[model samples]
Target chain A: MGKRSFNILDVTLRDGSHAVKHSFTEEQVRQVARGLDQAGVRYFEVSHGDGLGGSSLQYGLSAVDEMKLIEAAVDECEQAEVSVLLLPGIGVKEDLEDAVKAGAKMVRVATHVTEADVARQQIELGRNLGLKTIGFLMMAHMAPVDKLIEQAKLFESYGAEVVYVTDSAGALMPHEVKERVSALKDHLSCEVGFHGHNNLSLAMANTIAAVEAGAAYVDGSLRCLGAGSGNTQTEVMAAVFERLGYQTGIDLYKVMDVANDVVAKIMPRPQEITGSSLIMGYSGVYSSFLLHTHDAAKKFGVDERSILIELGKMQAVGGQEDLIYEVAADISKRNKALV
Target chain B: MGKRSFNILDVTLRDGSHAVKHSFTEEQVRQVARGLDQAGVRYFEVSHGDGLGGSSLQYGLSAVDEMKLIEAAVDECEQAEVSVLLLPGIGVKEDLEDAVKAGAKMVRVATHVTEADVARQQIELGRNLGLKTIGFLMMAHMAPVDKLIEQAKLFESYGAEVVYVTDSAGALMPHEVKERVSALKDHLSCEVGFHGHNNLSLAMANTIAAVEAGAAYVDGSLRCLGAGSGNTQTEVMAAVFERLGYQTGIDLYKVMDVANDVVAKIMPRPQEITGSSLIMGYSGVYSSFLLHTHDAAKKFGVDERSILIELGKMQAVGGQEDLIYEVAADISKRNKALV
Candidate 1:
């Protein structure tokens, strides 16, 4: 088989900041960006972990403004394209403009899987601003293939260069990934992208499945440093891709060095599939809800698994974090009644 | 598609001993066995990391005799069938007999993928003893599909009940796994099994692909505690299988608890895909060679990747630990000459 070409949009500075409680400083962003740049990473994603305007208290405040971090990343990643994620409600046209002004060359307009309609304006604004626009449908596992296709079409209609089948919960099986990605690839005129989480330890496998299903863009983070068990480690993905005789156009050893020397130092903890994280994946809960659920469970004296199960039952999406606390309290009260 | 029923051979005690340097105590074996049995795991593999007679200077001596470990597992596992692994060059008939005496109801006679002939006598001996005999072809990625089928046939002719396309290096891609397993299932009269390592972090995906392609038996270690980055975590595999709507007759939470409370305590290092381990997968070197190569590299002041690449060129198989030292020394000498 011929070597397959794909884009690796690394979201280390963006999605990964959640693991560090959105506390990424400008210097840290610069260092990570510099490392990624040196490793020949073509796309560097920089923003608050929750996307633009996500530095507020509900998401967790960033130590430094995300715009500062994006600017630092832009300054350091001279050769790589700097990108930012913007959720529709949290980040409006102005936020996207601010990010583009900070030198972000690309913007991923994100929304809940079923709420792609909400992302239309942002994607349009991103494109109008002359930024590379990618549509990120968060919690994509919640939608069926037809629904996912319907949602992806909305992105395409809004002029998204890429439409992502984002496995926000790390819940999609490899077969499911194949089905969804192949269908999206078949239907969407725009290039298909995939973002995976390692909550079930299936990120690399799912990513590969997506690639085989003709996904042109894949997202990863250095050291797998995103929410839950984290995203697929970019270095490992690059290595695996090279092993399969595909060109990632990135130096495998350089990526490894960055993961080891740079990313490892910033990691609050080594990302492993914990019980809560596994439950989130198994129950198809959002990956970003892991830490929130843990906190809620502790605060309300309820089991974290119960909180996760309830959240999953509620079909909570990325922006629904307040529901975590509400669900925890309700469960805690119910359990008290039972006792 | 209808849900498929496949056998899971839990090799935590057998293969995972490598991470602990073949030093698993009888009590540890008993604890793990009891937990697995309670979790409804049907097959419990207990042996040295290098198989039956692997308690030697070359493979690293076990803290307790493997016979004792097997005996303990057999005693603790009231329902699960106790199993053991025996490599051709490392183990002999006497060792197989001893394992059977220790109440190992099954035995997997293992050999290099291309060297299935070496396992023949052990399989025959195991069958004669009325043990469920399995043929384990290690480092299966080294062989082509036709060669693997031919090898599987060799094991079948020797009275093996199952023939495994074991990805001992964790090198097999999902498609490759699917193709090889499908071919084996098509050609072999007996059931086909798969043993996966997580060197490239593709263990679970490859295992799923193998199952989808008709493999009957799949192997995983608790907490992914085997060589290199380790085997697929039994808990994660169980969770994934359950999420895929396949009944493994095991409680996912119980497996997770065992991994968290018991296996985590024993793990010397958390299993993450390291550069050396990735090289093992990329170069298709034996997973067990990771530690040996690392030690050799550090001792000789040579690059472990170089040693692994050289080993790949030489097509080194299991029981070739001595060759790692030789290769490392040769590389060091050549590098010195260059200087």
Candidate 2:
């Protein structure tokens, strides 16, 4: 709200709900919305339905109650503003107008790196509706820096308030973030933002790298919930900002408590993988193995054979819906027998 | 081996077994040994029992039977020679001689960056036994490049056959790898080698960067099995070599098969993290969020919320671990439950 204009945008009722079925109740959204408001997060993404009818990726999950969303937008962020993101091939002019009327002060428009030009119309559309538009290129690193600069500038020129760099694929390294953010600052006359995917496990690092490299706004889901590896964690960024000598006006403990309650109510923690997990992520490789190693080890004596057998079959294990414990139990059974 | 000496060092029994526990069978080692020898990797690091005898953080996982290692070494590798790694605080002159008589052709003397002078004695001692000695640093990045040069020069004066530029932290970006390796190259007349961690999910990238930066011998474990996040995947490096038009004498499909089989039998495939993983690893920041987010997602229900929660607990999630699935699960679970 001040000179720097930093805001924590919670998306528990938005992006995170996508993982389940976009089936969040009005009550859950209301609680999270109020938490975000109380914790001083200035903005919230009211799911796609709040603007567009529904999301293209995760169908049925959108802000249908425009009035409720606006109320939360106004109430959850009494001191701050609310931001909504729109995807092309989804939201039309009518939806844009509806979003503005719903109290979305800022609108983020995202497109593929190659399709930034298409978002030009959306940015202009958002501006004409009296909403500040943030231009975003999903999978920013899919294209080169020069190309990214060209695209970011294109959106910024067309009434885009900020050029948002989105690492959708989670494929970029930190230096890439620095190099690109700097290039955006140097080339574009608009504030730059960063949204990262956890695929590379560097979402927080990249977010820090971006902010350090001059990104004004950082977009992370409440608990870093979104597609693939998920988005950056807003709460983490708040701490990062705090540590770097900036008073973000974020009641970090308050925000964190709300975030934990929401996230724990929403989901359990993920397996902390190393070695092969990292390699697979780095190589753009996939084969399962998630958190199976430790569980399998606990079950099957932790022998090389057991480990390899688990490794070989992890591809089968990963896509198996919610079988982490059973796999561990199975392996532990064998391990116990061995002992 | 040619002037550049493309030696395929099989530390699978050493480094690889560490990841899978000191669980290597005489048969498993022999199986890999015979295959690696047949495939024509240059050097075989005779199993030092996964570095168990070597205690400090300096020597990782030393527990393969040395005599059996020599027996396996002598029987399997027809053309590929042998090398045993020497840790300063662990082994004596007697161990090196025993290794030599046991038919080890070379020995690598390892030390921390501050202990390069310490390796001079070990290097000289190993050299006297008709062994081609290499000086290795465990955490090479802890020291500056100038210090690295100093270490290399000292080791070179002690008749070290190669001066290895190790990024034990997996901390170096590609550029840094090039800079450090080249700096070491400039200071020493001996060949340069490199070993890196996968903390940043850049083990393969950094190793490739090192090789491209003029590291003659690349140090990697089969299936990338080793301490912490583990070493680079030798098969991946072999693929890099093949692509670069270098003769690695590696059967890509064969190596892949063995690697796959080995991992399948003894270990889980490492988690596949994408861009964020590399960035965090490169930035050298630690946060448990990466691992927790992914796992917490599954534990909770909403991948997004878990990601946010973990990201929110940035201080709490202070080191890299695998969490791709955890993030996805949290987001999805919350979405389903709340929706």
What C-alpha lDDT, on a 0 to 100 scale, does residue A214 get in candidate 1?
Answer: 93
Full-model lDDT for every candidate: 0.87, 0.64
Instruction: Report the C-alpha lDDT of model 1 over A1-339, residue by residue, as the tens digit.
Output: 758799888998988988999988877888889989988999979888889999887788989988888888889876899999998778777888888889999999888889889877888898899999999988888988999999999999989999999898788888899999999988988999999998788999999989989999999998889988899889889888987788898987788888888888898887888787788888898656878888998999987887887788777776799999999999989999999
Worst lDDT run of 10 residues, candidate 1 chain A, spans A310-319
Interface RMSD, all candidates in order, equals: 1.3, 9.6
- Say which candidate scores most in lDDT: 1
lDDT of 2 by residue, A1-339 (tens): 323445445665556655545555566667777778788877777755323556444356443454465555566565667777788777777777776776778788888776788887888888888887889777576577999998988898888989888776555666788899999999988899887766545666677678778888777765565555466766655655554456667876566666666754664433222234333334332233434544555554553224433433453322453454555567667867888
Candidate 2: list runs displaced more than 4 Å: A1-84, A91-106, A128-132, A139-150, A165-187, A193-339, B1-18, B26-83, B93-106, B128-131, B144-146, B169-179, B198-214, B221-224, B232-261, B268-339
Off by over 4 Å in 1: A92-94, A287-339, B287-307, B318-339
Clashing pairs in 1: none
Q: What TM-score, computed on C-alpha atoms, does each candidate reach?
A: 0.90, 0.59
Model 1 Cα lDDT, one tens digit per residue, B1-86:
64888888898897888889987887777788888999888997998888989999978999998888888888887689998889
Cα miss at A119, model 1 (Å)? Answer: 2.6
